[model samples]
Structures are given as C-alpha cells and as structure tokens.
Target: MTVRETAATSSSNYLTRAGRGRGGQGQAFRNCNVLFHILFTLKGVREVASGQLRVLQISEKGLRASSRRKDIPDQFYMCIGDRQIHIGCVIVSRKRGLLDIRFLNELPTPFVGAVAALEDPFALLEEIRPAVFGLDGFVN
Candidate 1:
C-alpha cells in the first residue's frame, strides 16, 4: 500500500484501540478524539493549499497547539502594524482530514506583496503574531 494509505490505516487503528470509535466512553477517549481532529486539520492545511495562501510549517504548529483548546474560535486574525487584520475562518471536521478556510476579505497589501516576493508567509504570520478570537477564548 502507499505511504499515505498506510499512515491513514495506522491512525484509524490507533483511534479504535484508544476507544475513540462509535461507542467510546471516558474523558480520555474524548480528548484523544479532539486531538486527532486537530492534528489532521493541521495536516490538511499543510498539504492542501498552494500559492500565496499555503500554510507555513510554524503556522501549522501554532494552529495545532491552539486547536487543543475547545474555546478557540473558528477564525484567525493577524496582528500587523497598528491593525488587527481578519485573515480567514477555518472549519474542521472530525471525520475528515480536510479543512475549509474562508477568507473574510482581501488579504493585506503587505502580506500579499510579501508572498508575491516569494517570502515565507508562515514567518510573516509569526512576525505579526496571529490571534484567534472565539466566543470563549482568545489565543495569540
């Protein structure tokens, strides 16, 4: 089997063994389920997109870490210069390895320019400090 298929099967086996299947119980199982979704979501972000909006490695790490909190919002914002810029909203599904991100508006000029110049967008996100504003949590 292909590497991707093997990885997927292994992940599925792990989830089943961890009691995260259809009829799983206990808080630990639930937490494992959430962590699985977060990890796969970041993986999708890293592997799916291209061009100016491709997710950076550091940004993926940040997203993965922040996604551990249940209170984090579905959207992300970047703090650039004197403005808090709305970048996009992310919707992650528990049963799928893909995430849907909808941009709130046009990306900032500087960010676009940087990407156009072939600069690492993830580094730019890091330098600017991205923030997530959710109903119950604010993470930077």
Candidate 2:
C-alpha cells in the first residue's frame, strides 16, 4: 500500500482502539479544513488518577516518526486549527502512532469542537507541533 494509505489505515486502527471508530462520538465532529492536510479527530479527553492529570486521546495522520522518539518535551501548546485557543499538553506516550497527551488542565467543551475541525490539530508557536518531534510535518 502507499504511504498515505498506510497512514490512513493506522489512523483508523487508532480510532478503533480508542472506541471512536467509524460511528463513534468523534466521527460526528470530523471535518476537513485547510491547515495541515492531516485529517484528525478528538477521541476523548478525561482526567486521570483523581483528577491529578488530564489526558487527551487524539488520532492524527502522518505520525510514523514521532512515535519513535525517546524523549518528548513538556509545556507545548497543542493549538487547534487557526484559532487562538490552545490546550497545554505534554506527550506522555504514543501507541501505534496515537498520541496520549497529558494536559495540565481539563479541555473546555467548546474547545473540543474547534480542535475536532482543525486540519492541523496540533500546533506550537507558529509551526505545526508534530514536525518539531521528527514527524513528516504538516502536509499543507
């Protein structure tokens, strides 16, 4: 299969694992935008360990490289599309190219919709966040 096909498959598998597959809650909000060329969905976001740490399940396209990184930094803002709102999260771990970001605060409900519609779901500063971690960067 081609690289794009593989990436799509990988993203699908991730959604399944997160229980946000074809007909899942995330599917309803999935839409296309013009930022990163990366199609993505917000699987879910919840607090862990008595609300000590907030975690976010995000599935994205083109993550075959960042999954191999040994160290992911902290305090990076996971920006949503071209909006000013950002969720402060740190990459806790990755599985099958799925990112499990640990957020410092619970993501606001309104922000979820914004993020779900983003073509480039993860941005940092003025650039796409994934590229900073050795991913292929934004497709757009």
Candidate 3:
C-alpha cells in the first residue's frame, strides 16, 4: 500500500483503540471524541468562492510549521482584512517559535481576526482557547 494509505490506516487503528479504551464512559468518551477533532483540524484557506478562506486567527509559529510540511498544497492562501495573501506553504521553526511564511503574493494587513494576528495558535491550543480550536475539554 501507498505511504499515505498506510498512515491513514495506522491513524484509524489508533483511534479505534482509543475509542475502545474509553468504552462508553460517557464523559471520558466525549472528551476523547472532542480531542480527536481538535487535533485533526486544519488551518488555511480552503476555498475563495465560498468565502471559506476567511481566517479569524492563527499563531505565527503554527503558520511557519504548517508551511514546512511537504504534504501542504501549493495554492494555499490566507485572506486578511481586505487583502488576500497567497502563501506557498508554511514551515515550523522551532527556534524562532514562529511560522516561516513564504508569500507567493504580498503579505497584507491582517483583519481583526486574521490567522496572522496571533504569535502561536497552538500555544493557546488548550481547551480554553476557543471553539475554533474545538478542544474545549481535551487539553485539561
């Protein structure tokens, strides 16, 4: 099987094991389910025609980290305020603690809730961050 398929299968197996371990323990199960979603959520511009690229916030570090991922698509874009910024991809820089953003287009002024507004999206990735992260009870 292909690497991607293998990875997907492994991830599924891990999730199944986790779910089984929680085993209908109401609250614990619920928390685990929520954690799974939060951990897998992706941050980036998905579609412009649908206004789906509107990002409210993201950590600079996260942006950099994401840029470095080889699997990231080439056409990623982040819409900030009135301008649209096209980024090639993001890479995480451990030392700088910031997202190494490479712009295919000029970096624009981030909107009031642009992803570029934050220094680290995951730093506040705990359950208390916001509904956007969706981990509410997972971190705690």
lDDT of each: 0.30, 0.35, 0.29
Ranking by lDDT, best first? 2, 1, 3
TM-score of each: 0.27, 0.31, 0.21
- Stretches of model 2 off by over 4 angstroms after superposition: 1-71, 79-86, 118-140
Judging by TM-score against the true structure, name the best candidate: 2
Please report how far candidate 2 places residue 65 from its true position, in Å.
11
Write model 1 residue lDDT over 32-72, tens digit each, in one string: 11111121223435642111223321121122122323433
Clashing pairs in 1: none
Which candidate, 2 or 3, has the higher TM-score? 2
- Higher TM-score: candidate 1 or 3? 1
Q: Write the per-residue lDDT of candidate 3 for residues 55-108, one digit (tens) a residue.
A: 222232122232223333323344321222222322222243323333332222
For model 2, what is the error of residue 3's alpha carbon versus the real structure, in angstroms, after optimal superposition?
42
Candidate 2 total steric clashes: 0
> What is candidate 2's lDDT per residue for 19-84, written digit by digit as tens?
222222232233333222111223232321111121232333211123333333322444433423
Clashes of 1: 0
